[model samples]
Target chain A: MAGSDCLAANDWICGEYVRSRSQELTDATLQHLWITGASVAIGLLLAFPLALVARRWRPAAGPVLGFTTVLYTVPSLAMYSLLLPVFGVSAAVVVTGLVLYSLTILVRNILAGLEAVPEDAREAARGMGYGPLRLLFGVELPLALPAVMAGLRIATVSAVSLTTVGAIVGYGGLGNLIYEGMNSLFKAQVLTASAICVVLAIAADLLLLGVQRLLTPWTRGRTNARAARRIRIRARKAAV
Target chain B: MGAVSGAWTWLATGAHWAGGDGVWHRLGEHLYLTVVCLAISCAIALPLGLLLGHLGRGGALAINISNAGRAVPTFAVLVLLVLSPLGRYGQWPTIIALVLFAIPPLLTNAYVGMREVDRDVVESARGMGMTGGQLLARVELPLAFPLIMTGVRTAAVQVVATATLAALPGGGGLGRLITAGFNRYDTAQVVAGALLVAVLALLVEGAFVALSRLTDPLRHRRRARRQSVNSRGLPKRWVTE
Candidate 1:
């Protein structure tokens, strides 16, 4: 039955398909990458300080996180449409909405990472006459790198998918290919575009994983036990 | 300012509330799509995740599948299927796309939830002469309930938000409102549609929170009661409030 439709529909998946669509593919891929990158970058920039504030004032955590939750809960297409009156069909609208989407995860991860830093480490730093600022930058943030990287990986991958939804507004990366292909019933176009998007997402995730491994040498096999111990400590602290 | 008021007025008008294409009808379609997609995805992901987590194998595979799935945008999947033979039928393409979208969070969260249950607790349960099924039922599930619920909430919220895409294939939903507004060049109607979706998402979130509270057999964990016992008599009862 499926074959009946693709066959009768006059949509061919062939060599010429790849040749003719090269430029469109390249442009779409770039747009997708750029849009996804910008969302993650902006989300991280905003989430860092916001997370720190929530970390400092326990009371503000609920309201601040609640606001991000509301923002995130807005449907993707609706979020795009919600901003239509402001930015029209521009990439800014998608990026802005996605940044808001990314915040909930980013802020939560940043908060978790900061909290993961052992209290004893902080106390020891303080005992060594380190100021709050010094302790944060030199001690806590370094130890928190693995968790932060995990957040980055998640945000980037989700951004890739979210950017595709922006196609309804005419800026969705390879989404344009699928949209155009479906309209014309072009099987090759749809298949190729989906494959590429999948590749891009996996590549990005693996790249981030490598980066995480590189940055957090302590997370490697030798120092892995130390990391586990620190995690246990953080868990115990959370329980109390 | 103008857009907000215009949208409010547009929503207030009675014409938008009646007929097959009315807001109420579209809302039914939207809810139907969300619930169906969520139910199917959960059915597929929950058991597999729980089983793998219980056995402590295949976690990396499930997680990687979810992570890789992030790249296969639901829109692309929907349109591709819709263009193909499988899409020739009723709402299968739309349903399939939505199912794929819902799977990652549900699978990942459920898997992680199972794995994250305390090892010591499991050992203690085993030491107490409990069988695997008993340990899983009495100890593992209760401990994993919150995370599993969190995953369900994530999938449900996502399904609710993304169901707007079903309008593209002329399937049906609040998405019809959004696309129809765009086609008619009515920004106010578009704003109204988006607002309704946002409100709906929030409502779904609230419903899930309430659902979890009601069904969490392991927890009646206090939102209000934090008892601080003293060495002295009666523990000097006082509310954190």
Candidate 2:
């Protein structure tokens, strides 16, 4: 039943479409990557300072967290619309909206990471004459790497997902193809574009997870060491 | 400022709130789609999550599934479904896509919540000759209630937001207003449509927050105890426990 004219047959998995439109797919994928990267990177930069400010001041914490949470509650479509007046109908609107959405996850994760740094670590660093900045960067940040990395992974994946919403404004990378394909009922284009988007998000998540493991080597050993200690304790108890 | 005022004027117009293609109709459609999708998602996710969690099996698989689900864009799913054989079925593509989108949060939270219930509590319940079903319904369900509510809230809010995409496929919803506005180059109508969606989402979130507080078993127990104590004319100090 398979035909030589897959594209004309409206087949969902046509290699002909891929071969014919490889350059277009590449452009869309690159745009998607660029948008996701810029939005997430900007989000992290903004979230770090906001997290620091929230951590430093007792009262500011509530409003800072609350505002970001409110932003997150706003629908993606509404968020872009709200930003549209300021940024006009451009990629800037999408990027700004994404940055706002990422703030809630990023700020909360960063703050949690900072708070989880043991009080004794801070005390010990102070005793060793470490400055506040040095302690924050050297001791606390290293300890908080896992949580921060987790946040980064989440934000990046979500950004990749959300970047599709940008297609509404004609700026969505692969999303452009998906939207156009949907309009014309182009089965191959819709399926291929969506598959690529899914792959992009998964790849980004896996890459970030690998980076987290590499950067937080201590986290890997900590779990193993704890498990080993537990086994040794059980053995000792049995022997006695 | 002019655009803001323009949107305000568009919202204030009585004509925009009526008719077959009006704000009210679209709102109703959006809410209906959201509710149906959420109900379907809950029905599927909760039982599966509870069973897996109770059995202490396949939890990692469920969580991983959810994480992968999150990576799939709801918009792409919608478009893909509409382009497929499912397109002719009328609303099935949208409903199925939405259900898929809403399932991840519900399943993840339910599974995680069930797993997080105190192991000691479960063991003690079992010691008391509780059957598996009884243990799950009475002991585990109460403990996991808060987390399950959190999942529901997340799913509900997300479904509401994403349901707006239904309009893109010529389905009726508030998103239609936005799309229609875009076609007409009416910035005010687009903004108005966006505002309605955002407000509806926030309202859904608030409603769930209030609902969870009202229905929380732990909170209900505390309130019941206080009410009984007051009815018995006990001293206030004795109510501390």
Candidate 3:
């Protein structure tokens, strides 16, 4: 214990940190990605259908949104602690916690996205004899893609950050590095982990932004210009 | 079923209900951490956000910086600060880290609120011979109040939750119950502690909602505001509520 503690002191260099912590870093990063990715995928699957139900039945919207909102407000630490007994310290518990957090954003964006779809497009599709399922899949979903993608970007980045909190549950990704580093007073390990997490988050966010742009061509440059114009126009018009 | 019953038993223990390490002490510590950090964060973020919104020049920068700030994990920041020279200063590291985490939402919401104020309304106020101060105080600030309150509510709720991390830094907070539970493998204690945190967070959220309602008469006005529906049944506005 004395020997390990001594080794941690004043050791903020790159080489020493890599030599001792490489395996820990690799394991953490992978676990973190797996936990986050799996949770988000699950969340999307659940949230999309729930969003549809809410949209279809106006009464369902209040309860669904309220439930998810309550879930969202729960502290992540408390949430992990709550699940501690039920799922133990496994990745399953951590993923479930992250999934609950993701639902609110995903559902809100999906509903907003679906609702944002143009009436003309829907009418035109119906005029062309498209069925309800066909219209939802082919016309509505595609138009709502941009907003949904934006929500995904937020959820993914947030999950990445929150996964670190999972360290308490023993499923922390780069978070484990941080926890270990702080407890041991190892400056190098802590610095490296933080740097990595930041870089990873930024890279993920930029990549998603690029993906959103690629997926939504019609919304390019035009949406912001249109929004501004609409706001300006609204100033002149009285409330309907 | 037994898990909840166990949690109840843990809470019912007289020993657990009193003493230096009691739930009340932990709750006080939790609230202190949340309130102090939130106050500091608001002091910095609110003024800066409101200023930027008034100028409408550097708001994009504020938003981008905050986004980048949010991208960095709060745990990582807390850990780094705890190991640095700052950690020796008794809760400074934890407070600073929490402040950083709280800033993004505060800054973004305030700026967004301010910017979202109708430009024509500002112009009309100006035409009515209102000074810069009067225009801001009388027109812009009032209009931006709802969004700003939304930001405060969001920041407060998040801070209440994240403040539990204060325990990991060898600081005092309600998280001690969970940490101690994990160490002892006491599931009941952990559940109770978690319940306390969740309840505290919800309480804070509820308080904020009431605050928003009381303060932002805009809520009523906005409700009366007619929402335009497009050809598709969807709202023309981005958000409904």
Question: Cα RMSD (Å) per model?
Answer: 6.2, 4.3, 5.7
Clashing pairs in 2: none
lDDT (10s digit) by residue, model 3, range A165-199: 89897788888888887887878878888787878
Of candidates 3 and 2, the better by lDDT: 2
The regions of model 3 sitting more than 4 angstroms off are A1-9, A221-240, B217-241
Residue-wise lDDT of candidate 1 within B1-241, one digit each (tens)? Answer: 8889989999999999899989999999889999989999999999988888889999788787776666667777777778778877888888888888888888888889899886866776788798989988877887788888988998898788668877765678898998899889999999999899889988999999889888886554433223533332111222121
Error in Å for residue B92 of model 2: 1.0
- Report lDDT per candidate: 0.84, 0.88, 0.85
Model 2 root mean square deviation, Cα atoms: 4.3
TM-score (C-alpha) between model 2 and the true structure: 0.93
Which fraction of the native contacts appears in each prediction?
0.92, 0.74, 0.94
Error of 1 at A116 (Å): 1.3
Instruction: Give the per-residue lDDT digits (tens) of candidate 1, residues A1-240.
Output: 554454455555555566666898899999989998999999999999999999999999999999998887888888999998899779998999899989988998888999999999999999999999999999999888888988888888878877887877888888877777767777887888888887888899899999988887867875778888999999999999
Q: Is candidate 1 or candidate 2 better by TM-score?
A: 2
Which candidate leads in lDDT?
2
Alpha-carbon deviation at B79 in model 3, angstroms = 1.1
TM-scores for the candidates: 0.87, 0.93, 0.90
The residue-by-residue lDDT of candidate 2 on B1-241, one tens digit each, is 8779989999999999999989999999998999899999999999999999899999788798778877998888888778778989999998998899888889888999999987866886788798999999988897788899999999998898788877776777889988888889889998999999989999999999999989987775656656675654333333353
Model 2 spans with C-alpha error above 4 angstroms: A1-4, A229-240, B220-241
